[model samples]
Target chain A: MRIVLMGTGNTATVLGRLMKKCGHELLQVYGRTSSSASALASELETNFVSTPGDITDGADIYIIAVSDNAIANLAGELKLGNHLLVHTAGAVSKRVLQKASRNYGVLYPLQSLRKEMDDIPPIPFLVDGNTSEDLTLLYDFAKSISNQVAKADDELRLHYHLAAVLSNNFSNHLYTLAEEYCKAKQADFRLLLPLIQQLCLRMNRYSPSTLQTGPALRGDSATIELHLKLLEHMPGIKNLYTSITKSIQDHYRRTDN
Target chain B: MRIVLMGTGNTATVLGRLMKKCGHELLQVYGRTSSSASALASELETNFVSTPGDITDGADIYIIAVSDNAIANLAGELKLGNHLLVHTAGAVSKRVLQKASRNYGVLYPLQSLRKEMDDIPPIPFLVDGNTSEDLTLLYDFAKSISNQVAKADDELRLHYHLAAVLSNNFSNHLYTLAEEYCKAKQADFRLLLPLIQQLCLRMNRYSPSTLQTGPALRGDSATIELHLKLLEHMPGIKNLYTSITKSIQDHYRRTDN
Candidate 1:
C-alpha cells in the first residue's frame, strides 16, 4: 500500500508513523508548510512534498488528513485523478474528491491524535467512501493497522463526532469544571480523581442513567435544597445542577412511564 | 472496630458491606423504618434498632448514612451523648451533629455510592470533626479500610463534593449527552468507549489540560462552527456547547498567558 500523506497535523504525523510501522509504504508526506512535511517525511524515511501537485508519481492513496472545511476545496486543488484521495475528517463528505480523483473515501481515526504521542492511541478507525469499491479499499487499508474498524458515511460519521464530544470533550469539560470548583474552594483537586475514575470504570458494567444516584434522582427536595443553597455563590454550577438534575428526573420518569 | 450502621440507603449499603468485609464488628444496624432496619440488620448479621434512640448500647462508631438535610435533625433526635457519631454526607456541615452530641464528625466516602454496586468503590474517605483528637480517631478508622484517605472539615468537604460533581456527575452527564447524540443519529455509542477510557488513562501519564485536543482548544473555528451547527436542534446542548467552549478558551488563554 503506497500511501501519500497530506497535512502534517497531529493526526497526519501520528498516522504516518503508524503506517510506516505497520509496513505500509509512506510514498511521500505533503503539507502546505515545508517544516511539517519535512518533519513527518523524515520520521517516515520518505520524500517530502510541499505542493499538492508535487505528490509522488507512484502513490496509490492520498490521505488528506486536513481540517473539515478544507477537505472540499483542498481536494479540488489536488490533482490525483489516478490516486484514491481521502480526507481524515468526520463532518466532510467523500464527494469532495469526486472531481480530483478516480476514487475517494474517509479514514477517520475516532480519537484525539497527539503530536507528542510516542505511539498511536488504541482507537477504532472508521472508513467510508462513495462506492462499495472505494469503501472496501479504505477498509482494507484501515484493517492493515487496526482491528477496530467500522463502516460509516458522512451523516453517521458526523453524528459519531457529535456524540464523541459528549463522551470525550464535553465530559472532560465537566472534569475541568469539577477541578475548578476544587480550586475555587481551595481544596485539593486530587481528592476527586478516585471518584472520577470509579465513575468511568462503572460505565463498563452499567448504563449511566440507570446508575445515576443523587438527590434529584431520588426526588429528595430536602437534600437538593441544601445543595442549591450551598452552591449559591457558583451560578454556573447552579445552572448545571438544575439542568442535569431535571434531565435525570425527566429521563427516569420517562423510562418508568 | 465495632460499628453501628444507621440508615439503609446507598451509602450505608456500600459502607456496611465494605466495613464487614474488612473484619470490623457490626454492633447493630439502625434505621428509621422497621423494614429497612430489619433488611440491613439481617444482611449485616447484626441486631436491628427500631429508633434512633434505640441504637446499639456500645460501639466504636455510628455511621449515619442518610441524606444531607436529615443529618442535623436526626442528630438532634438521637440520644447519643458520649458515643462517637458520624454522618456520611458532603453538603451538610459537621456542626449539624454538634446540637445532638459533642462527639460528632463527618465520615464522607468520596464516591457516588449505589445499592446495586456489589463491590466497594475505592473512595478517598474525607474525615473531619470538632477537634484534632476526633479527627485522629476518624482518620485512623478511615485508613483501616481505604488506601486513599484525607482530613477535610465541613467547609473543605463541601468543596470536595462540588469537585466530585464536576468530575463524576457532570462528567457522566456529558457522556449521557453524547449517548443521546449517537442515538438520535442512529449511531453506536460503544464507539466512544475507547476514546473516553484513553482520555482517562492519559490523565495517569499527563496533565489533563495538556491533553486537551479539540477544535475550540486548537482554535479551529471551522470545526467549532460545524459542531455548533450540528447541535442547533438541541437547545439545551447548544447552551452547554457555548458555556464549555467559553470555559476551555478562557482556561487555555489563562494558562498560556
Candidate 2:
C-alpha cells in the first residue's frame, strides 16, 4: 500500500516510520515547514512536499496529520481525485476532506506519540470512513501498522476524543498539581511514582471507581481538611482539591445509599 | 529483624511477604479477626494472634499495619516493651506509637499494595522515628525490603500522602469517569488504555504540566463546551470536566502571562 503522510509532528513522524516498517510504500511526507517535511521524508526515504497543492496523487491513502484547525484548509488544497484521503485527528471530522476526495475517512492513533520513541507504542488506531469500502480499506491499513484497531464513526470518535482529554490530558494536569504540591512541602515527588504505577496497573483488572482510595473517597474529613489547609496558598489547586473531593464524596454517598 | 505484623490488610500481607522474602523472621501476624490473622500468618509461615495481649512482646519491630482509624487504638494494645513500634501509615503521626513503645517510628511504604501481588512492587518505604537511633534502625529495615527508601518526618510524610491522594486516587477517578463516559457512548474503554499508559510513562521524562495537552490547556472553548454538553446528563462528570478544564486553563494562563 502506498501512503503519503501530511505533517511532520510527533504523530506524523512516528506513524510514517511505522508504515515504512510495516512494508507500506510511504510515497511522500508533507509539512508546512519545508525543513521538517524534508527531515521526515529523508528519514522515511520518501519524497517531500511543503505546499499542499504539490501533494502527489495516486497514493493508496493520503493521511493529513496536521493540526485540527489546518485539516480543513489542507483538505481544500489537496487535489486528490479518488484516492482515500484521511485526516489523523480525533476531533476533526472526516467530512473535512469531502470536497478534496470522494473517498475520505479518519485514522486517529489513540495514543500520545513521541518522535524519539524507538518502537511503536501500543497505539490503538481508530479508523472511520465516509463509506463502508473506504472504512474497510482504512481499517486494513491501520491493522498493518498496529495490532489494536477499531472502527468508530465521526460522532463516536468525538466522544472518544473527549474521553481521551479527560483520561490523558486532564489526568496529567492532576499529576502536575501533585508534583508541585510535593515540591512546595519539600517532599520527594519520586515517592508518588509507585502509587501512580500501581493505580495504572490496577486499571487492567478493576474498574477505577472500585480502586479509588483517598480522603475524598473515604470521606475522611480530618485528612481532607488538613489537605485543604495545606493547599490554601495555591488557589487553583485549592479549588480543584475542594471540587474533586466533593465529587468523590457525592459519588460514594449516592452510590452507598 | 523479627517483625510482628499488626494487621491482615493488603499492606500487612504484602509487607509481611516482602519482609519474609528479605530474610526477616515474621514472628507473628495479629489482626482483630482471628481468621484473617491466621490466614496471613500461615502464608508467611508465622504465628497468628487475634488478641492484642497475645501479640508477642519480643519481636524487634512491631509494624502496626492497620487502617488509619485503628492505628492509635491498635498501638495502645501492643505490648512490645522496648522494641521499635512502627505504624505503616503515611498520614498518621509516628507519635501514634508513643504509647506502644519508647522507641517508635513510621514505615510508610509509599505505594499502593495488594495482597495478591506476585512480585513486590517497587516500594519506596518512607521511614521516620522518634529518635536518631530508631530512625536508623527503621531505615535499615526498610532498605532490606526495598531499594528506594527515604527519611521523611511525619510532617513531610503527610504532604506526600496528600500528593499521593491527588496523583494516584484522584487521577484514577478521572480514568473511571473517562471509562464511564466512553461506555455511555457505546465506545470501548480499552482504547483509552494506551493513552493513559503513555501519559504515565512520559512522567518519568517530563513534568506533567509541561506535558499537558487538551482543549482546556489550548483554551479551545468550542471543544470544551462540546464536551461539557455531552456530559450534561452526568452531573458528577460535568462538574469535573468544567472544573478541571478551568484549572488547566488558569494554570496555563498564569504561567503564560
Candidate 3:
C-alpha cells in the first residue's frame, strides 16, 4: 500500500514508521510545518509536503493522523480521487472524511503512542469504513501491521474512547496523584511499583471487581478515617480519595446486595 | 528466625509460605478457627494452635497477619515473652503490639496478596520496629524474603497504604467500570488490555503525569460533551466520568499555570 501520512504528531510519526516497517510504501509525509514534515519524512525515507495543496495524489491510501479537531478540516483539503482515505481518531466519526474521497474510513489505533519511544508497543487498530469493501480493505491493511484489529462503528468507537479514558487516562491520573502524595509524605513512591505491576498482571486472569482489595472494599472505616485525616491538608486528593472510596463501596454494596 | 504465623487469611498464608521458603523456621500457625489454623499449618508443615495459650514461646519472631480490627485483640492475647513480634498491617501502628512483645514492629507487604494465586508477585516489605536494633533485625528478616525492603514508621506506612489504595485499588475500579461499560456497549474489553499493560510498562520509566493523554487532558470539550451525552443513561458511570474529567482538568490547569 502506498500511503501518504498526514500530521506530524506522536500518532502520525509512530504509525508512519510502523507502516513502513510492515512493507507499506509511505509516499509522503504532510505537516502544517515544513520542519516537522521534513524531519518525519527523512525518518521514514519518504518525501514530504508542508501545504495541504502540495499533498500528492499518487498514494493508494491516505491516512490522516492529525489531531481530532483538524481531521475534518484536513479531510476537506485532501484530494484522494476515490482512493481510500482514513482518519486515525477515536472520537471523530468516519463520515468526517465523506467529502474527502469516494472511499473513506477510519483507522483508530487504540493504544497510547509516543514518537520518541524506542520500542513500539502493540497497537490494536479499530477500523471502520463507509462500505463493506472499504471496511474489509481497512481491516486487512490494519492486520498487516497489528495482530489485533476490530471493526467499530462510530457509536462503538465512541464507547471505546470513553472506556479508554476511564481505564487508561483516569487510572494514570490516580497514579500521578499517588506519586505526588508519596513525594509530599516523603514515602518512597517506588515502593508502590511492585503492587502496581501486580495489579496489571492480575488483570489478565481475573476481573478487576474480583481483584479489588482495599480499605474501601473491606468497609474498614477506621483506616478510611485515618487516611482522610492524613489528607486533610490536601483538599484535592482528599476529595478524590473520598469520592473513589464511596464509589467502590457503592459498587460492591449494590452488586453484593 | 523461628516464626509463629498468626491468622489464616491471604497475607498470613502467602507470607508464611514465603518465610518457610526463605529458610525461616515456622514454629506454629494460629487462628481463631481450628480448621483454618490446621489448614495453614499443614501447608507450612508446622504445628497448629487454635488458642493463644497454646502458642509456644520459642519463636524468635511472631508475625500477626490478622485483619486490622482484630490486630489489637489478637495482640492482647499473644504472649511473645519479649520476642520480636510484628503485625502485617499498613494502617495499624506498631504500638498495637507493644503489649505482645518487648520488640515489636510492622512487616507490611506493599503488594496485593492472595493465597489462591499460583505465583506470588514481588512483595515490597515496609518494616518498622520499636527500636533501632529491632528495626535492623526486622529489615534483615524482610530482606530474606523480599529484595525490596524499607523502614517506614507508622505514619509513612499509612501514607503508602493510602497511595496503594489510590494507585492499585482505585485504578483497578476504573478498569472494572470500563469493563462493565464495554460489556454493555458490545465493545471488546479485551482490546483495552494492550493499552492497560502499556501504561504499567510506561510507569516503570516515566512519571504518569507525563504519560497522561486523552480527551480530558487535551481539553477536547467537543468529545467530552459527546461522551457525557452518550453516558447520560448510565448515571453512575456518568457521574464518575464527570468527576474524573473535572479532576483531570483541574490538575493539569494548576500544574500548567
**Residue lDDT tens for model 1, B20-135:** 98899998888888999899889888889877777765888888898776777777788777678899988788887876667889999998888787777777899997877889
Report every candidate's CA lDDT.
0.80, 0.87, 0.91
> Which digits, one per residue and each the tens of the lDDT, describe model 2 over residues A130-231?
999999998988898898899999899999999999899988999999988887888888778877977787778788878888888777899988888888
The fnat scores of all predictions, in order, read 0.55, 0.83, 0.81
Candidate 1 wrong stretches, greater than 4 Å:
A45-47, A69-74, A216-257, B32-47, B51-54, B73-77, B218-229, B246-257
In model 3, which runs have C-alpha deviations exceeding 4 angstroms? none
Residue pairs clashing in model 1 are: none
Ranking by TM-score: 2, 3, 1
Q: How many steric overlaps are in each model, in order? A: 0, 0, 0
Of 1 and 3, the candidate ahead on TM-score is 3
Which one wins on DockQ?
A: 2
Chain B TM-scores of the candidates: 0.96, 0.96, 0.98
Docking class of 3: high
Can you write out model 3's per-residue Cα lDDT over B1-257, one digit (the tens) per residue?
99989999999999988988899999999999999999999989989999999998888888999988899999998777778999999888999899878889999999988999887789999999999999999999999999999999998898999999999999999999999899989999989999999999888889898999898998889889998998888777788888888889989998999
DockQ of 1: 0.51
Residue A135 lDDT in candidate 2: 94
Residue B80 of model 3: what lDDT? Answer: 77
DockQ numbers for every candidate?
Answer: 0.51, 0.84, 0.83
